[model samples]
Target: MGQLMGFLNIERKNQKERSPLERVNDWNEYKEAMTEEGARKQAARCMDCGTPYCQVGVTLNRGTSGCPIHNLIPEWNDLVYRGLWKEAYERLAKTNNFPEFTSKACPAPCEGSCTAGFVSDPVSIKSIERAIIDRAFDEGWVVPKPPLRRTGKKVAVIGSGPAGLACADQLNKIGHQVTVFERSDRPGGLLMYGIPSMKIEKDVVDRRIRLLEEEGVTFKTGVDVGKDITAAELKKSFDAVVLCTGAVKHRELPIEGRDLQGIAPAMDYLTASNRHLLYNEPLESDLDACGKRVIVIGGGDTGEDCVATAIRQGCKSVVQFGKHGRLPDRRTEGNPWPEHPNVFSVDYAYEEAEELFGKDPREYYVETDKFTGDENGHVTGLTTGSFKKIEDGRAEQKKWDADLVLIAIGFRGAEDRLFGDFDIEKDPSGRVILADERSYQTSREGIFAAGDARRGATLIVWAIEEGRKAAASVDLYLDGKHSLLKS
Candidate 1:
């Protein structure tokens, strides 16, 4: 601890944000950088605890208890507090391959398990982390350090998301020639298109992809594996193949009139809007929510993103529906302190929606029944039923006007289109069948699976962890020795 008992005197203050009224008018990051002094003060609030649970990454009761990548939080906090910016960056780089992505997009499960939060507010760890990485880049501390010698083994990574990128990065650093294949014109599977710019600007994603290219990772875009090329050809061309295709098959809202026009999946809507913003292309008429009464039918992070996107698109009004009731203000008995406390707070989208519409757009305890359409098959309104809770009975149905509807329900599993072509065995739920409990190797010897393909839909941090471990497994298989690469 750089400053003993500093937690007693310091009050928690997170990073500032642009005013909602001003920020909603443009597509830029809502958060502003924290001052050096503010970040240092926040880092100094780290308490001297013998057991640092913040870095003890694990799942308890099916909830994340800490950082999944096992970040060295206390060491970096002390380094930042002592004004050793470069040292902090070094420590951060040892664990996380991309702090810039996680600091902006991740939910920050590390702070939920902070020991300091037991007595007072949790340390602003995410803000300090962003500050360290940003300073490192500004000082030219981050540069390409590719391996001096090549191992003469070629590896193919089949997706360019966080998991694939991390696996490729570790393998390239360890002297293997790695190539990444992406179906889209650009890399970064979810980060490039699925997420809105308000959360993380596209330049940040591009900056890392460019860095990877400089470090000896070849990226081939606009090439679908199962369609453009056969899986058997890829297996013969590369020494080994790693599958990182994410869980992208969105779950459907199979109510009546699902075939109606103006109803679309949330990912499709986001990808279209992101393409429009980045490439200046026209948005599909049904996907565009401008001047339309938009209704998002799922209450999750993706739903929130839809709400924010609709607001930026100049929607006449927006509303979100969640089947469950609102969360409690404080942690319940079932959710303890270090178990990723399940509580309620106003998220950025909610704040922006409140600022623009003069009320929160979320309607809790509401479930969609069916969609009503006009003569042209365009959605006009929807029927919803409200209930106090799941344990109780449902109330009478009510009608709400809606011009566009976005189904933001979560993903079911990975797309099964390529599984049969690859000759890969998949579980009934569509996840790849691994050889064993502790291995990343699939039923096929040369092919390995990681990230969402094996684990279903999960957090980005877990995906990175899966990728690192899979890289280690691949390295061991290739060289017939224990891998030195960190997992």
Candidate 2:
């Protein structure tokens, strides 16, 4: 409550974004940072309600009501209001390990639940968060702080995505030696590869990875776990093993022509695109979207990334087929404040596509029937159908022009290779089965699973939460009841 009536006296000042026309021309972040003074005023708008639902950290109606990581929102907001930037950064770090990543990538359910947003605009929580963390780095406040002492324990964390990275970070802080294994050439799994550079430029991910290394977390890349290192070996070598392997098995559109030369999974296309951008790899037709007719299936983050990628590649046309019809502009009665509202808003990719193509690439209520290809066997076009209702099974079918197709529907579960080789029991959907009513441990003792691999594909913040929780569990398993980490 830096300013008791600050919310009433001062109108909200949101951070402005770079023009879409200018941003899409390169692979870089588009949003501009808000000023320190502006952030303080915005912080003054925090009402600091007794409940403070912006950090409620609960799930309802299949959506997040507030920040999943339970970020100390009001604390930092008040600190910023008092011009205590360093204090704000310290408060921010207490909850979130990577505000920079989340600020750029998260949908900000915290803002959705803001008291001010119930009437007018919400507190600029996301931008203010980004400002605090970015300034922390710029001021050299973010430096390596190796643990005070060693616990004489070792933990092997599989996968280098957010969950793995977060788990490694927590374990290291508690003085447990941690090593993260990644199959790819780079360390960050989704953060470095799955997400496009336009949303969060590569260097941001790299900066964090470098810091993690400096803090004593070992990163081993280009080493497949199940193949190069066996589960038996990990269990024998390390005191405990935490599996942070994300749910990466993509749900496929296995219709006819799926085997065509140009048809590939969303990850393959995205990974290839990311590799090209980060490593300067040669791009082939299937991997490149430049000047080709591009059609993306599924309308989630992956699909949006494909649309953004295609636009940046100078594709002839971009079309996204969303199985569900276009969402309402405003939240429906079913989606009240504090819950993640199911409403329509343009993302960075959508804005870029709109500016470049003169129309939004999304075709709602559309479903793919089958893909039709040219005589040469390379993908050329596909068939589609419309859905009158999301529950409706049938609609009018038609053919659409497409040279490249990216399927971004969603993930099924973890890949069969890594977990399956452990001889671990699996759920009906192939996810590693947990032990008992509440457990991160699997049928195999000393082995624990967290994040998407356990709960299926979820938000990034949720992944970080799972990692922290699992790391605590792993510490308990290692150091018994005397350990400081939460069980």
Which number leads on lDDT? 1
Q: Model 1, residue 464: what's the lDDT?
A: 91
Per-model tally of clashing residue pairs: 0, 0
C-alpha lDDT values of all predictions: 0.89, 0.85
Taking all chains together, the TM-score of candidate 2 against the true structure is 0.96
Question: After TM-score superposition, what is the CA distance of residue 411 in candidate 2 from its true location, in Å?
Answer: 0.9
Prediction 1 global C-alpha lDDT: 0.89
lDDT for 224 in candidate 2 is: 88
lDDT of 1 by residue, 1-487 (tens): 9578887788888889999999999999999989889999999899846888898889998888889898899999999999999999999999899999888888889999998887888888899999998898899999998999999999999999999999999889889999999999999989889989999899999999999999999999998989997899899999999999998889998999899999999999999999999999999999999999999999999999999999999999999998778899998999988989888889988999999889999898887889999999999999988756456765768899999999998888877776786788886655544434466888888798888888888888888988888888888889887655545
Q: What are the clashing pairs of model 2?
A: none
Highest TM-score among the candidates is held by which one?
A: 1
Those runs of model 1 whose alpha carbons end farther than 4 Å from true positions after fitting are 387-390, 431-437
Candidates' TM-scores?
A: 0.98, 0.96
lDDT of 1 at 411: 89
